[model samples]
Target: MTDSDVTISMFERIGGSATIDRLVDRFYDRMDTLPEAKMIRAMHADDLGLIRDVLKRYLTEWTGGPRLYTPEKGHPRLRQRHFGFAIGDAERDAWLLCMRGAMEETVTDGAARQDLNKAISGLADWMRNRT
Candidate 1:
């Protein structure tokens, strides 16, 4: 099979919206409880409900599932949106730690899990604003 024919979207591999929701929920759960994630977690409001909804939408779109995010929020402009935060190596690593844990718990396919980790790690690295 050609690359186009063989390759499935990360969303499909991740079992679509329901699984994505579970992953996002678990990610925040880890962030809430993990001491390593405290700095990143402090960046959010006490209630994770709203952020979880936003993440579900964003991840859905990001993983090539649907366009739920932009219709409501316009451009993601992720870096601009995150400019207020000081995301150094520590914060990025902590964020990745929670995400890696979430993906491990939610995603079953090995290749899909690895691909997701690479993509997420790249994004997290990009989100870093400090030296």
Candidate 2:
């Protein structure tokens, strides 16, 4: 196929497993330490290990690398799963703050980073359950 005919998944564009891992790690690191993320951080377990792995797999699958998430977790009904949390605009912003910082630190490609940021920002917005 010609170069223009080739379609690269966002996963590949962002450097696959390694980048996803770093992104998730950085995201949680920010949540674990940032003052602004305190409310949302409180919703998570003190031990971030399990969620970290889950995010890695979810991001991997979401970005089109491999079916690392759904094969085990089924379709990511992310909003439904998060319904118990009191997610509001502030919570969404806090999440975006962490995710944006993580994307900046981990994702090297500018275009890919921007795309991921937009998509993830949408997701964070979507997760809001409160007005």
Candidate 3:
């Protein structure tokens, strides 16, 4: 089957907003504490609350639940937003490491986990702003 055919909406696979919140929380938690995440973690503000909310809303719309982020923030423009940061291979890998841990803790379905991992990996790679 094609990837789209096998793909489930991130909302359904992740159990909606509550689960997304948990996932984001766990992701930030790891970023805050993990030694490997130090470089990427330093890029974020001391207060992660707003960032968490933004991510939660963005993921909600991305997964087909609601368009909350777009309505408030306009287009995602993910790459553009990340351009101000010095995202290289190390930073990208650190972000992915945190996200992978979060996904492992939040998603139980093997297929869903793989799908999310693939998408996240691609996004992380795309976020790399430096050579």
Candidate 4:
């Protein structure tokens, strides 16, 4: 199959919200535990429940599922939202490391994992507020 055929919506490819839930859950769990992710994890609050929901909703809309984020949070001005944080190369790389580990633990399909990684890389790069 061509790339287009292989390119399923992040929702369908990930088995819907259930899979997303698992992915996000495992992601936070890893972030909470991994040494390499310590810096990024420190940025977040002690409570990860709300953040997890936000991520799920945001990803839901982002992956061509539903427009939950836009409706609830308005436009996703990700860079603006992240501007308060010091997102230098180190921070960005750390975030990517955490996300990559999460993806590996959660995603099973090769194409879907690659697509999510590419999109995440772009988003992480965009979230950079510093060098």
Best by TM-score: 2
Off by over 4 Å in 1: 1-6
lDDT of 3 by residue, 1-131 (tens): 77878866778887888888888999999999999999989999999999999999998888777788999999999999989999999999999999999999998878878988998899889988899
Q: Pick the candidate with the highest lDDT.
A: 1
Ranking by lDDT: 1, 2, 3, 4
lDDT of 1: 0.96
- TM-score, ranked from best to worst: 2, 1, 3, 4
Runs off by more than 4 Å, candidate 4: 1-7
Candidate 2 matches the true fold with a TM-score of 0.97
RMSD after Cα superposition, model 4: 2.8
lDDT of 1 by residue, 1-131 (tens): 67778878899998999989999999999999999999999999999999999999999999999999999999999999999999999999999999999999999989999999999999999999999
List model 4 lDDT by residue over 17-43, tens digit each.
777888888888988998988989999
Off by over 4 Å in 2: none
Better of 2 and 3 by TM-score: 2
Backbone N/Cα/C clashes per model: 0, 0, 0, 0
**lDDT of candidate 3 vs native?**
0.90
Relative to the true structure, how large is the alpha-carbon lDDT of every model?
0.96, 0.95, 0.90, 0.86
How displaced is residue 64 in candidate 1, in Å?
A: 0.4
| RMSD (CA, Å), each prediction | 1.6, 0.7, 3.3, 2.8
Clashing pairs in 1: none
